[model samples]
Target chain A: MRLSVFHPVSSLIYFAAVLIATMFCFSPAIQICSVVGALLELFMLESKREFFRNLRFTVVVWLAVAVTNPLFSHKGVTPLFFINGRAFTLEALLYGVMLGGSLSAVIMWFKVFSKVFDRERLLYIFGRKTPKLALIITMTRGFVPKLKAQYRRICDGRKCSGTYMSESRIERLKASCGIFTALCSSTLESAVQTGMSMKARGFGTGKRSFAHSFKFRFGDGVFLFVCILLFSAAMIYSGTGKLRADFYPRIAVSSEPLPMLCFAVLCAIPFILEVKESLKWKFCLAKI
Target chain B: MSKKTFSNLIFLLLIPLLCVAGLLFFRDKLYAWLSVGITVLCCAGYFLHFEGKEIKSAQLAIISAMTALSVFGRMCFAFLPGFKPCTALVIITGMYFGRESGFMTGAMTALISNFYFGQGAWTPFQMLVWGLTGYAAGMLAERLKKSRPTLLIFGAVSGPAFSLIMDLWSCIWADNGFVPPRCRKFFVRLYRNDAGILVSFKEFLCKITENWQVRRAQSR
Candidate 1:
């Protein structure tokens, strides 16, 4: 049960929970939960540095979006001023930033989830009857690695062929295009062969059996119960419109920060205990 | 650093000035292409010139100024609205500098400014539009600064025009349902009310004064 925390099911459940909570709750609920989900994914996913780096990138991108958005959107109750014959309102810009931050957070969360749920595991979970779709998802999962490998190959080739480091952006873009074309051609060929192999084995037609390693355990049940409680509380606050989120001409109070912080802490309890256990073991070993 | 470098900088400035003037004069395909082409060219030149070079303190300061201005502008628009862009500060700053400054300003403004505004749906296009605007401005500035008059004229014309550009960009996003169609439609509907129209007209008058103030501030 402790080991399964490192598995894909956790991420799946996390993703599903985020999606459901975001869909059902108010906008603030979506924002807060999504942020909490991203934070958890960042801290507990083992790839903490990568997650933090991506979070920083998301912040940078979110700022860019916030600046450009307000000029066009002059909506909402409070009017700040007017620019160039337009009534520029704080509401518009606030909404833009809120929307942008939520989006970036969601994207960051998904990326963290993907890191935990690699293609092999995704296929393992859904492979028996829907082999074709499973294979596609698995292949899609490797797209970034394949693309990077091909890009490196093209770069090496270009350097070997006397392409200087001082090439223009356009030239670099063109070089990448060449690499992409090569990769696409090869990937298509491989896909065809894979399709043929799958057809031969009757991959799509079968009574599906679950060979995946997600066992229903006591800890998982306990974790899920706590998750449900937290989510239900979030949903209650959100659905009642009691979870306020305002920022424009003043500030919007979304969920109470303390409660959200407490929820975040509760979610981390398992990982915290795991670390404490490990540290205890190490201390015992040193004593011996 | 040298007389030749100074002269080269002046020469580079002319190209963008011409592009901006051409865009204003032509108001069609050539105008759009002119700014875009000159910007791309200047960005290429900047890359070539500054390749592998560490940024000087002054350059870093300028970059920070640009980033701060962008963030300030975004926050103002989001929370205060009073300090919103009467002039396209991002565009002007970018044009005066280079692509690196422009891109950073554009990108950072969107992200940091959202601190006051919760994350919403319309962020991606906002990032792209501002980014392109800064990138274009920098390129134009690099290409057109041969004469002071041209620079001033381009600055004046672009300041007001940028507001229009943003409005149009919003229209594209709104009509296409890219994000916030409901919010947009609701606002427009509200504006269609008689009181809203009067308020909008009053806002228009206020905007002109705000624009002038921004211009004066920029000159300093």
Candidate 2:
């Protein structure tokens, strides 16, 4: 849904609120709303194939948790069935389903999180706060493709030397190990040099500054403020304990519809933003 | 161990104990939050540990290279169901460098590899286990370097140790408590998947560690 149109910080704050609420708020309605919102945003952002791929994994997780939890935790009343003389209670089953829903919702949000917060955005968001860690992560990202290339080169060299050839699986395995060892020593030596060279270049001395240079535009500020307002309203309402649902002994729902509506609106912010953006685009097209 | 690094290690150690205590106290409802808390704390702790230290760029580069190598090793072995050399390589890094470096290498390997493999709730648990493996190797570095057998034994022991922690995590995740039978089942399934690589894993790590040990001695 063009989440990247918002600033990284805005996106970060939005996801953080949703995640905290989903994990902490025990209301089934809130959790369901959060999952549906995340799924809707995911559908907008990803192709059908990719969306289904993610859905498949998350659904499996939900079903597995929902089905297995009741089997192990036999703590509720209203037994639905009995296995080996232990009553499989409805409360436990519902509780498990509730747990699964929240857990999967969290996962879905993170999936959306990963997709939206690509490398540059992450670097922009976290780079300044922890420069050394950011630098390491950046360097590692830069190094993987290079290292993979080097590994391929090494394998090719072995193949050319006739050392890599073998129908015998053990022989190829041994050659691969040799190749790995060779790559290790070379990389380690170069890395030591890289470290020493960095020492000469005056790194990690003090005030290591970084940012991908993201502009906090007027639109970003508006988005962020809206997120905070909605988040606080949802949280304060949920915090009053009116939005909590208790499943032990029997399912007793204690929630105000207004708080759930607050949460649902907060969750749907992405969709609203996308619709607004699309409408603007269509307006501009008509003008053209 | 400098005070900062030592304190950092203590923090790392305290988190899991606190997690267990939390699970016991809360008793079944807060596990998803608990996992989220763990993931955040581990990343924050790792960041704070390295943020302002007099760590050289070379040291940073070295850690990046080690992490890249470990991740590359993992990707290379992806075809084989469970024969991952990532743990053994991480242990080697720990044995060669200090503990913090080891922990960084191990943790970063999990984080970066998951970019390709797809991250989820399990990422933090994997990072914790692998990082601890490296940290333990660093702590026992003297013994690990002194003899071939000890190095081999540590390598041999680390696979099961990694699986043990992950299996424990799954038990907590699914059943919401320590269901022993479920844990045992996970352990066996994991151990069986891992059995094929243990011999070569240990042997390869011992050889690499021996090479570095000699070089380190010569340099000193």
Candidate 3:
């Protein structure tokens, strides 16, 4: 199994630590480390084509954030140029790029996060904490595809009946609205039926027991421990003015090397694990 | 009035004050706290309002179904730029079922859909905006039920409202402080596209009402 598919708790802790570090740490070095780590992890877990598709999204977000920041924010002393009467500062521009990079890094991490923690994992974690909420999430997940199918069926039916042949904007709007109203009513009606069936099955009567396929092993425990230790160490360094950056008056970042190294190690944890796992798998396959 | 109604009234009254406080005092440092605070307050009010009455499984299912429908509706119309029925569905839900249900549906829809769209700092703001639209629709449910034109107007207004609230987050994040001129520019650019969706949605609602009336007349 992949390293990220470890026990749910381990997976959550690792992702949460990396995401928090990525979001809170303002140092450009740490941000770049996170972006690289996330990209490497994605490449390891997903296909090359998938990685490129995801990269497109991150690049767009990064560019937008980078370009817009300097226009709205005129902070810092080093003026690059005057843009439409507003002073565009070098610090602000650099800060914008850093912000965009961090934002993209966060987005990439979440992409990995969503892949690891699918609906089943989320339900496993949240079921005991809040059963009703978990049930609602499950129901919502189930309903999305069903609703899409229903919409297609409705559209096809309308087309067959010559009702969907509308060239005017108003006629198209009416047809779309008609389709939705039908969908809304039918879904609600079916929901009531489903609710009745669930009630009859003794739902919401008492404490519910969920069957989970995840097993916590000694390796998972050790993995959690190492993640927690590294995450806390990185956070402590961040708190002690080691990861500080000032972008307002001028661009300044801490010259400390130890904290940056610690952050780099923390961000690289996932990529390292994935590489190790794949190497082990390859060695075993060669022996076989 | 019952204690719950009185408390809800007070909560409604405090929303404006909260907005003003976030704008005037807590723009830089406490902005996240303020956004989280508003979300928590709205959710707390929802739960409190529904306390003691076992919100039946049917009710939960309906909320889930409606939220799913809205999210799917958004996905289906992805080819159409900015034309989504998310707000219209929320309005209809609020009109039929009470305010709390409306709020729950809107907030949950935003949460679940963000799983696909990629969650960010802006998710909470989107939830708050959609939730408030549903809540306001519920508040004026009586009037909206009586008049289709009023419902259309409300739907139109809500489209812009959702866009404006979303832009507020971008404004705060981009500027790091509230700058009126920049905000106005951003709002205009963003709302211009969103306004098309709202107008289309309004027209859709009007068409639906007219068809319903005609069908009723024929049946009678």
Candidate 4:
């Protein structure tokens, strides 16, 4: 009873399909999907410890967005009321929570998507003619790691110098200036070095071939087909002119039932699959 | 890039960004003292970095005085209700320094200060706008430093002019937050508010603008 999940690409296709569907539904369904998606991703950490290593930053970002958004927006009718002169409206807080959660979820999902359709895989799929696209993929994939590593090294260097005084404002600013100078210089150098490395490897050469790790099995075909169906249905719903933006002082209600149901079905697919896989894993582990 | 350098930059950027977010969120309670404290801290930070050199002392004293003037102007602006003269602090610093230094100062100041107001997503844009204003002021300062009267004029005009520039940036970011769909009226009202302050300080604006225009026109 070991749980089996779709390949990353297939998983991504399904997620994208669901997202597009939810967007077309033009109601509160998008918020639900986003929150559910974010929670499911978060739960991945709780249930499977290994996933946390990859998702910790993402989760923090999501939480930050969720927490801070409500604090600032201060909109809506439901009176949570009274922080100083400002009346923190229940509606604004809730909306901000939804908006922030959804925004973070979408951003994290895209991050996951990039991880799934990794630079090498995408490059292999797209081939050498598209250098700009390849460069973008490489940078996007590498960005977080680069920033994280850089942040750590600078802190370490400061610590080693015994100049790392977190308590003093002036000391921190000097350290920051030193760090900024160092960062700008190194980044420029790295850009040049990376360019040279690419050239040395004959990046522009037409002789390169890529063999992707993901093979399109029968299951993959089913996943892709289902995604296509979902995406097409979503697009059709949008074409009928029912999709609308409800963001402002108030959230809008959707008129069409067909769009809503179809949207719900699409958005709920990933959650269903994830739950199925998790439960299956649990049952199998119990037997052991 | 070396791992060490990259991490350092992120850490530096993050501190100010988070601080600003905090500032923005809590600005109502903290605005009066927080702004003054940050302005002092920035100048103090500069002084501490250079230690006890004679030139450093003079520069530090000047910045300290500037910080005091900025706070005073800001407080006076509050009383005047719509006079936003303190936006010149970053611009003046930038003008005196070069563009790069001005940019760094402006960005860092805005980011750090915004923390007291309460940090949100808008912090980055404010940093960028303020940084750009500083950079522009620095570039302009270099071109006008030749004559005493022109320098004085530039100094006088920079305060209110920068408020206009910063407002334009804020308008772009906060349009969704407060502005209605038909925002032409809003822009007009904003322009009127800004222009009204300049009109009240007519002598100051006139002196600065006259000198600025004469120099600018001469250069052309």
Candidate 5:
């Protein structure tokens, strides 16, 4: 499914629920589920090349987190080895793996979120909540790219004028500083112009209305309901100790498997939706 | 004192006291939660305080512009390793504008730039550090504006302060508790790179200030 096609509110709810659930749920089973679900969702949503490219970074991060946690946190009973008089335990290693998995899952979910929530949708959501803050966000969003273009122009102009050429470190530094100052002044000047134009346009005088392209539909409602249900169920399961795991003194998992299965299904909802949508599209193409 | 100033004073005082209390009394997870909680409270307090004031479009425009410049500046210097003008720009913003604007700019820069850099738990901590740096500059604006040397010193000092705050977050995250000795290693590593950048930043500010002065003289 094109998650971005959903109403902003529905997408927001889904992401918020999944991301928070992944972060808060520390059990190995839940963490693994989250990681797998996130990876599948990313693969389905992103192009294969893009998915692999992102996967490399996530793997590096996962390895780093997994490695470092075991090194720093030397808790648990089963001593795997002794390094520099510090004991590396099996439980700590497992804990680190879980932490790494959960972290990567969270990161992947955010990547998907960024794809879905483009600048306009973000502005729409924030504008509804706080207009002034939304205006600032919008301005900054527009300003960064403009400033980058300006910086490049400044650099090119300076290079041509030989103002940037200097052998001495201090001279080079001062020249760059001159460029930076010029940039700042120009930026400030343009900001003043923007402010004046906004004032003329009756900005900050009254409540502002935003033109929204998307509206709440039945599909959005259903998506939002599913998200809420999954989130609440996960929370309830976690709260009742059905999803408990301890890795400090010793590694232990909860004997009850029903709640863990439910949690996995909850996490898999997004991936399932995407797969179902893709299959439907494929079938329609075949029929044609 | 007026009620608003009184509350502001109380908030200003309460923050440090709470920090000390959190450090001395709470450790590990509780301290982590407390730090996060305090940051949220301070951000909320600043927002509410700003809401009470009359914010002109000019102020908002300037803040947005400055924040964009700061983020871009950070990107420009990304290759230099620890030599970003974000803190300097934030300080400059605070020196010119009020504290709230500075804080907003700093906080927003952290939030927005992370869209490029990727966000995690560290984002909030970064926001707190940069926001407080801007807030500090705003608080000391009067003294800093008096002399170029003072501004330079503040710029240099803020670099270490920024690194120290970031190091504290890492220390908290890594050890799950603050150990002074463990934190020292991280500080030493950061200080080596950060100090050079900060000193250069001071010189950079000096150059900018000189240019501004010359412009003013010519205009007059």
Candidate 6:
């Protein structure tokens, strides 16, 4: 199994830490590291085609933002050139590039998030906090397809009666609306029965219990601990003014290796895990 | 002078004031963070508010059903891009059930339909805007029900409201044109007004639950 199987909250915490660090910190070093980390991680989890597709998009957005930043912003002292007597500054270009980098980082992270985080994981997270809301959401999600099926049935019946043979587009919309109305009423009617059934079964009477599917193993705990430590260290290290994320008046920064190393390790944690897991699998296959 | 006055001033005046100050200090650098924070907080607050309610199983089922209906409407009308009955259904749910329920239906409709469409950075914003529209419809339910013109006007206006919120977001992120006056006024007023709207939100919830408890007591 991939690192995604390592307790849902562990992955969630790791993702949250990365997001917070990337989001709040505007340093080029971290942003570049993030871009590399994201791309490599995407390559590890997803196919080569998926990796290239994301890379192509990220590069385009990064360049476009970088190029456009100089046009819109005339801040900073160093001007590469002038357009309409407005100074096109190097600092703005760098700032724009970083901005684009961070934006692309966000998109890539979310892409990775979508891959790791499926609907079940989403439900799991919400389910812990607000079971009722999660239940409602689940019911609603399940209900839509059922409603659609009913809508199809209604349309089929309508079609048989020559209702859809309307000569005009407007009439077709009208026919669809009529079907929708029928669907709505029928669903609402069934909703009452569903409610009655739920009432009889005694939902929301007291505290609810669940059969545990996800066990927090020792590895998960260690993973969580390492993530929090690195996140806080990076945050505090940056807070102490050892490293800065400043751009556009001047690209002000100081390179401190420790925090940067911390971030790299944090980002590489999953890549490391995936590699280890794959190697173990290969060894087992060789033995067989 | 009064306690309520001070509270209103804090929420209505001070929060927006602090937001502007933060905007000035950070400049455009933190727009991404700001948007993320806003989206997460708004959705979290909505869900938390939902959890703190006393809802019956029957009510929950109806809410799910209504939410399903709106999403289904959106899917059915996918052939015609601009002509989804999702908004209409949301408004109707709000008008009939109440604002919070309307908000739930609207928010969930956006949330669920996007699963079929595609989830993006814009999903939370869409949820917020649609939910707010349903909420406004709920708040103005009686007036809307009585007056056909008012309902029509609301239908007319809500389309722009969604677009406006989205435009403000895009303008902040993508538009390299640094700082228009209109944008400034809008940003300030929007923060101020939305914060201000929270007071009315509190009042509306109180009115709803108070009536609910009283009606329950009467029946008992």
lDDT of 4 by residue, B1-220 (tens): 4444544544576446645643443222133223333443443333232222222222322333333333333332343455543345555556554565455445544544442233333445455556666677778875655555564555456545555555444333332333332244445655667654554334332333354456558879
Ranking according to TM-score, highest score first: 5, 3, 2, 6, 1, 4
CAPRI-style docking class of model 4 based on DockQ: incorrect
Which of the numbered candidates is closest to the native, going by highest lDDT?
A: 2
How well docked is model 1, in DockQ terms?
Answer: 0.01
Model 3 shows how many backbone clashes?
A: 0
Structural similarity to truth (TM-score) of each candidate: 0.47, 0.83, 0.85, 0.45, 0.86, 0.75
Off by over 4 Å in 4: A1-12, A21-25, A45-108, A111-129, A135-166, A186-201, A234-258, A278-288, B1-220
lDDT of 4 by residue, A1-288 (tens): 101245556665666565433322333555565556545644542446645653665567656655544455556556566776666675665555555454455555543444344446556543444433333333433433563467568769889988664756445544543553354334434554655665666554555455556566787778677667766764565544454345446656453666555555655555566677779889999999
Task: Compose the digit string of candidate 3's lDDT tens values, residues A139-187.
Answer: 9999998988898899899999877646886676667767887887688
What ordering of candidates by DockQ runs from best to worst?
2, 5, 3, 6, 4, 1
B1-220: candidate 1 lDDT, tens digit per residue: 5445744764678676766644443222233334334544444344334333444333434444444433433432333222234124555456555765565456445533443343333343344455666677677775544454454454445443444444544443322233464446444644344242233223322333244345558879
Tell me which of candidates 5 and 6 scores higher on lDDT. Answer: 5
TM-score between candidate 3 and the true structure: 0.85
Ranking 4 against 5 by DockQ, winner: 5
User: Quick one: best DockQ, which candidate?
Assistant: 2
A251: Cα error in model 5, Å: 1.7
Per-candidate clashes come to 40, 1, 0, 26, 0, 0
**Which is superior by DockQ, 2 or 4?**
2
Residue-level lDDT tens digits of model 2 in A29-104 = 8889999999988887789999999899889989987887777677787988999998889988888798789888
Q: Which 10 consecutive residues of model 2 chain B have the lowest summed lDDT?
A: B20-29
TM-score of chain B of each: 0.44, 0.81, 0.76, 0.48, 0.81, 0.66
Q: Which stretches of candidate 5 lie over 4 Å from their true place?
A: A163-178, B1-38, B41-45, B48-52, B174-176, B179-185, B216-220
Model 4, residue B81: C-alpha shift (Å):
28
